[model samples]
Each structure stands twice: as structure tokens, then as C-alpha cells.
Target: MKPASTMRPVRTAEAATTSLFHRLFPVNRDIAIKSIFGVWGAYFVFVTSRFLYVAQGNVDALFVQRILMTSICITSTWLLYRLLIAVRGRGMKSAIFMLTLPTVVLANYIAILDQIVFDHEAVVFDFSYLLKAVDFASFDWAYVLDEAFTRYFIFAGWGALYLALSHSQDAQRMMAHSRQLERVNRESELRALRYQLNPHFVFNALNSVSSLIIDRQNQQAEKMVDDLADYMRAVLTGGAQDMITVEQEIAQQVRYLEIERMRFPERLRYSVDIDQATKDWSIPSLIIQPLIENAIKFGVSGSDQPINITISAQSEGDRMRISVANDGRVIEPTARADDRSTGTGTGLTNVQDRLRTLYGQNASLLLANSKDGMATATIILPDPSQIFQDI
Candidate 1:
């Protein structure tokens, strides 16, 4: 699963990128249906107008016949649309075979309609008189054959056009979604980077565990060891999955902060005020880890007083607002513009990029000093009800 999941996108993206036609006419069913209606509707109007102008008021019968003929053609071709949808994703050979049968039926339908409505020069020699003993008026074999010979091409052409639109739209959408998932996977790989895997931090944790065991605080040492193991496992598991519930995310963060608390028990304090309503909401896994990491690394490192970090999730209108705020540092908004001032700016940028990739304009990440003088990074994303249905 890991090898295929990790490498399949590289091949799929490469194939999908070569499709310039799909890019220009992206996959949209509504647009495709509108174009079909627009073209057929225009053809109907043009034929009716031509009959009216050429014959004037003397040929009202011809105008009515033209409407009937256009209606038959439109109905037959709409059946083709339904057929195309039913046989979609079959290979071109199968699709073409499926389409050819309907075009033959459509041509026959139109040819029969012509026999009923109009008396053309061809009707005189339209196999009706040749086979006087048979019902040639109802089934003009020659005229039907002639219509099939000429008008079969039109339905065939429409079939091919529909196929192109169907497959192109699927390909283009698949490509877009595949690229976003690949981006998500790449970001997830950075989950265990920086201070989480720093050698000094690992050493400090081990030494602290050993000191607790030496002082016969075996329960504290055991709990710290468990927390350390659980935290690493949680963050490292980010690669394969992109989304989890808000409740699950907060649980993982709690493990992480518990481990950190062992490291700076007196200096670092944290709390979670997640709304009960938001526990079921979907969020990108480890999406909030960056904010927490930044708060601890910058906020805890720079401050002498005990820094209180608060993580909160609130339901605000049509969005779910989540924030990680710390009272230690009041970050100047302009300071973020200088990459050097914020050390490794990877955390904030990673959160921002993930938000954009996952939710586009519907999601946002902001870093600023709050009214209480706490440095906060707030993420605003679509409410679960709105976004989850599509997912």
C-alpha cells in the first residue's frame, strides 16, 4: 500500500499533464449539456426560419414538418447521450460500437418521419411505387438507406464529440484531485521534522525518564515514556492519511504537549477548549501541529514567565475557526515578512500551504497578535456540513 500510494501519483500526474485539450476545456457536465442543447437548439431554429423565409405563408405545413423532424432528431440524439453515460469508461472501441447502433436507429427514425410529413421529389421514386404490393409508404427502404448513408455521419460525429467531452472532463478532474493529494502526502512527510526529532530533545527526555526511575517515581517515568512513544507515532502516521476528526487531532496534540510538559513542566502550560460541536468535524491530520510547534519553540524559548498556550475551536457562522494562542510573545505582523526573524518559517508556511491545497479560498490561516496580546495563528475552514458532503 505504501509503495503504490506513494509512487502512483508521479506516473498519473505525468500522464495527466500531457493533456492540453483537457486543460482548455476542463471537465464540467453542466457546460457540456448546455453546449449540446445550444447546438441542437440553434440547428432547429435555423431550419424553421429557412422554411418560413423560402416558402412564405403558403408553406405553413413545411414549417410544422420541420419542427417534427427536428424534434425526432433531438429525441434520438438525447438517447445517444444517455447511452454514452451508461457505457462511459469502456474503451474507445466499445464506446464506438455502442454509439453506432443508436445512430442507425436515429437515421431510420428521421427518414420515416420525412416520409410521413413531406412529399419530396424523391418520394415519387422512394421505393413506394416500385413495391406497390408492399407497405412501402410506411417503410421507404431506399430513402431510409439514403438517410442512414448521409445522416448517420452526423450522429456518429456527435457521439465522438460527447465521448471526448466525457473522458476529458474525467481526466482533468482526476488530475486536479491527484495533484492535491500528492501535495498533502508530501507535507505529511515533514510531520516529524525539527524539534520533534532533535537529538538534544530525545536525550533530555531519556535522561528525565531515567531520573524519575532513580527517584522511585516509576509511574511518572512510565507515563512519560508512553507519551513520548505515542506522540512520535501520531505525528509519523501523517503520511498515509490526510484527514481525521477534530477529536482525534486534539488527542494526538494532547500526547505531544504531555511529552513537552515533561520537558518543561513548570514553564510550559497548555489547555484545549474545543467545542463539543466541533469534535466530529473533519480536519487535515497534523494540520494544527505546526501552530503548536511554533508556539512552543518561539513562545517558550523567548519568555521567562510561565507561558500559557490555549488551543480553541469555535463554530463561527459558516466556518470552523481554530486557533493556537500563547501569551508569551506578541509577534509584530511585519516580523513574519523577514524569514530570518522567525527562524525556520516552515511551520506557519506549511499550515498555510496545506489550507490552500485542501480548501482553496474557502480556508485561510492568519498570524497576528490577538486583543489579549497573545500571539495567535488562526485557521478558518468551511463548516463540516458544507465541505463533508462533497468529500
Candidate 2:
């Protein structure tokens, strides 16, 4: 089981950053653009006021200040877009590099073009004029790089925040799934256990044992008692667990079936075919025995034809499939409920429930009546090794 407290740090960081970005910026692109426009508009008003104070009524310098502020706003908007992609997958370094380089070249070009080429009076700006206006002392290339780096540093911090938030949400979802699966597993085990202790079944088996004693078969009757004891012990002890190996459960079933064979020596015949590869596979305990019992009771006994029950196991991909078929009449709606009820309907019901619990609707107990008077009940369970590895 994964620890409740531990989490992947990268995933955690990404989730937090993603969530924070959504909360702060929201999804409405028009609204976001409008909000940015409003902020820049206000900044322009504040800058105009400052320029007026400094020039003391000179309108030309105020015009230049307005142009500088507008250029800064456009450059900032472009950088913000690049920062968004960086938050998605690109780390801090990529975000900063991409955002800064383009914005710096563009911003500097806009400033130089303003003073040199577009001087309002058509004053031509030559190489020397643009070079002198570069102002190495204050507006040097190093200074521009430093400013761009600082702006992107803030953007990187926001990206980290969103990343953390994304991971937390994913962890929360997995935790919920784990809890649900655990509950379903418990229900499957409980239902499997409950069906194992069918009252009518015990009563019938005991009655059969008594008949053996009445016929003066004292030795056989004692053996029946011993077999019943072992079957009950396995059912009781193994029922608590969710699953047991196919090999172990089948061994118990063989013992139980041998006891049943004693009751109908000539009437009942049984055969089992299991692939060697699937013997050690796992399945919900006691799943097959009930089907076999049903076959013997409904198909073989009291009918003119001798009952031949066949149990087979196979594997498909990561799952193990098994089928139990018996030579019996197809159960019709008009068939007496009392006759059918003699065996454990509880067992069949439990098998279906366990299948649903473990694999939701994908796993199932399938029943079909063949043309040759063969009734088959097929059970498909997830392979335990594969299931364990997946979890």
C-alpha cells in the first residue's frame, strides 16, 4: 500500500501552481484582456500626472512618457503569454529565457525607433544618433538583462505554485479510488463466506450420512463424517480471506466431491481439466464447488441419464477462466421452485455477487444450456498475480 503522507514532489508542485493560476487569472480570455487593458489605462493616467509635474507644463516630454509606458505594457503582455506555456511543462529556465530574449529585443527596438526614426518633425536618426541614445551608463545591455530576469523570476514562482496544486488533486482522486476498492473487496469476501454455509445443504448431507448408517455401512458413514468435518473446516477458515490459490481451493473441492460420490456411486460421474500453468492462480474461494453441486443435484440425480459433471480451467491474458458443466435439464420458468431450492441458490447468488464486487460488471458467472442436455456455468475471475501487480 502507498503511504498516506508521502507524495511525488514534482506532481505536488505542478498541481498547486496550476490551481493558483486558474484562481488568479480565471478562464475568460476576454475578461483577462479587458482587465489588463484597464490596468494599463490607469498606469497611463498616473504617468501623465508625473510627467506634468516634472516638465511643469511642457507637453513634448509628456508625449514621450506616454509612448514609453504604452511600449512597456505591450512588451509585458507578450512576456505573460510565454510564461503561461512555461507553467504547463517547461521549467523555470526555459520560461525565463524565452520570455526575456524576445521582449528585450522588441522593447529596445521600439524605444530606439521612437527616438531615431520617428522624431515627429521627421528628424532623421543615423547610426551615431541611435548609438549615443543607447545610454550605456544606465540603460546598458546588462541592465536590460537584469530587469528581464527579475520579471520572469516572479512568473516562475507562480508556475511552481500551480504545479504543486495539480499533484495534490491527483493524489486525492487515487486515494478515493483505493478506499472504494477496499470496501468492494470486503463485501466480495463476506458474500463468498456467507454462501458457503447453506443450511439446507448441511441438512441434506447429514441426512445422506444417516441413510448410510441405516444400511449398516458403519465404516463408510464414519468416513463421510470425517470428510464433512474437513470441508467445513476449510470453508470456515478460508472464508475470511478475499481469495485463495486455485490449487488449494480445488483440492478442498475434490475432497468434498469424493464425499458426494459416496452417496451416488453409480449415478454420478465427475471429470476435471485444469491447465498446469493455472493451478497456482488465485480465485475467490469455493466458487466452483457450488456449481458442481448444483450440476449433480439438478442434472444427474433422479434423472434417467447418469450425471456427468465436467470442471475445466483456462487462462486469457491476465485473467483465469473456469467452467463447470453438468448433464442436466435446462431450468425452465415453470420448473418447481421447491425442487430447484433443494440445493444452495445462495451459493449461485454469492458467486454472482463476488464476481460483481471484484470486477464490477466485467467479471461474471455465465449460464447456458447446450443442445446435448449439458448445462454449463462459466466463472471468469481476474488473475490474482496480475491484479496484485496492477494495484
Candidate 3:
């Protein structure tokens, strides 16, 4: 808007770029045809421009003569493109060697066509005239052979270049397609692992609800049922497609504990300790649920006193740390991590499997315990920035 003159150059450059792109890459994605058109078109423009620059006369006739020459070159190369496509790597070495015959024959045809057009001031392809033109006393067979020799390489070189580029592009396209399929298959596997939790978790939650009803605690039972519905809704909806913000995950787990609170209203208390900086960070959804379940199962099975479960998230250098810890049992330093008192450690194993699937070896789940009646299950993500990048 500042000046029309200044804007004109930008618009002109954009138009030129678009025109060049269209010239190189045609409307349809035909690599063979596209390569021929682009290379030959560039060659024609360059050769014609050079001729016009260096020569002193006959600009209009030279333009027409060059147009005819370019048309012939395009047609000849197109036939080569078609031959390469049809052969498609069969007897490739022998086939290319045999192509020398056609290349040599066609190259001589170019020389003949040029001679006829120059003599008659018009295009002609008469075979009889070809015999007549060679009746000259000064006919040099040596020069013709030399010119044909050079032209042979030009034709052969063009065909070889096209094949190399076409094969390379095809390979690249295949590799990209393979990577996409791998991603889809991995996501499907993650989903299968995620859904494994549903049946086991629902069975436990229903049993807890049933216990509440038998104890004549109708109000707590109703509250737990409502919380369970809300929790399922949050999980099966938008946030469950493999990743969830630390904040959303914390919210979902809080709902889970609210249901469990019905069972141990006095004995179960939980806390969430998420740093403000880590709330928006993402992790695999429902990853921490199993650790919490194990905490309650192992911690409450042998104790009559209150147990405090804590969920915490914090940043650790380039990594992010998420832990579910409980005051249920002190993890003895000598105890195997997979060994717990009340269960077969399936919950911890499941969480560990999921972390390995999502982050490979770059992420880990660790079980640590302290002497002060504290047991911790922590997940360490080495690169939070890469966790949800693909998703």
C-alpha cells in the first residue's frame, strides 16, 4: 500500500516463481513426463537465449527454427521416457546398451532434418531426399560419425539421469509411507494397552460401590456412582486419545480417588502436588491410575490406620518427573521392585510396559521407598518436548 511501484516488483516475482514451479512440476504427478518437460524446457530456453545473444541477424527466423528443433528434441525424449517406463528395470544393462542403435539412428535423423529444412526453408522427412542429399562430392562421413558419437551420449545420458531420479523419488515416497504406517500401528497398540485397564478397574470400583450399599451408606454410594460416571466420561472422550495435559490427568485421578474415598472415608486421604510450570506438560493418559490403585491395594490391605496418597509433578532439567507415592508401606530397600505384599505387581508392570511403549528407553518408571513409611512410584520422561510431538 505504500507505493504501487514497490508492490509491482513483489507481485511480479511471485508470478514468476509460480510460473517456474508449474513448469518444473506439472498438474499431474508424472515423474517421467515432468522430468522430460522441465529439463528439455530449460535446455531450449538456455540454448535459444545464448544463440540470440551471440548471433547478429535473423532473430525471427532463428526463433522459429529453434522452436522446431525443441519440438523434435521433446518428442524424441518422450519416446525414451515411454521406453524406460515400459521396460521398468528389466534387463536394464542390456536394454540400455541396445538403446544405442535407436539413439544413433535418431541422432542422424536430426542432422538430416536440419539439412532439409535449411535447403528448402521448410520441414521435410522424405527418405528419397535423404538419399539425394548425400550425393555430394564433399560429403564427409567422418564428421557425420563424430557428430553422431557425441549425440549418442546426450541421448543415453538423458535416459540414465531420468531413471536415476525417478527411482530415487519412488524410494523416498515408499519410505515416508512406511513411517506413517508404523506410527498408526504403534498408536493402535497404545490404545489396546490403554483399554486393558477398563475392565479390571471397573470391576474393583463396582465392588467398592456394592460394599457401600451393603453398609447402608446410600449417600456415599450415590456420590461414588456419580463420580465414577464423570470419571469415565472424561476418560473416554477427547483427552483419552493417548495424551493428556498434566492438569487434566490430575483432575481425572482426583475423581478416581473421590470414588475410592467412599470405601475408606476415614482411612484414605490423597493430595496432588503439581508445579504451576508442569501443569500444561503432557504425558500418556491414564498412566498414573494403576500406581494409585496399587498403592491402595497394598497400603490398605494390611493396615487399620489412615494412608495418605500423593500425586506430584515437577520439572527435572530437560526431563519431567511424575510420581504417585503412598504412606501405606515403607518400601524396604532390599525388596524387589516387582514384589508387593497384596498383589502380583501387575499394576506396576502394566504402567512400566506402557511407558516403554510410548517413550522407548528414553522414559522409565522407578519404585523407591523410604524408612519413614513412604513408598514412591515415579515416571521420569527424559524429553517432555518430544512426548506428544507426533500426536
Question: Highest lDDT: which candidate?
Answer: 3
**lDDT assessment of candidate 1:** 0.72
Candidate 2 vs candidate 3, lDDT winner: 3
Question: For candidate 2, what is the total of clashing residue pairs?
Answer: 22
Candidate 3: C-alpha RMSD after superposition: 8.3
lDDT of 3 by residue, 1-391 (tens): 4799999999999999989866644422376666667776886788678864596365566566767766887788766655556666586775575467777787777655554434433333323443564543444556656656755676777777776787788789889898778778778777777766646568878998898899998988888889888988777765455787889888889988888777787899989899898888878899998888878876764578898898999998788999999985545434645565445666677777777767777888888886776898898876655642333
Q: Candidates' lDDT values, in order?
A: 0.72, 0.65, 0.73
Q: Choose 2 or 3, whichever is better by TM-score.
A: 3
lDDT of 2 by residue, 1-391 (tens): 6565565776788999988777655533444445456555665677667754574443664456455546565456535654554454566566556545654554555444434433333222222443444444434455455544543443334334433444465577789899879877667665645556656558877998999999999899999999999889888865675577778877877887788788778877888899887888878778787787777767766577668888889888777789888886556424445564554265677777666655675677878887887888899877564342323
> What's the CA error at residue 49 for candidate 2, in Å?
34
- Least accurate 10 contiguous residues by lDDT in model 1: 121-130
Which stretch of 10 consecutive residues in model 2 shows the poorest summed lDDT?
118-127
Candidate 2: stretches off by over 4 Å: 1-181, 184-195, 332-345, 385-391
Better of 1 and 2 by lDDT: 1
What TM value does model 1 have?
Answer: 0.52
Q: Which RMSD values do the candidates have, in order? A: 13.7, 14.8, 8.3
Candidate 1 lDDT tens digits, 54-150: 7544355555556666777777776777676666567777788876776787777677666655544233223343234435555667876786765
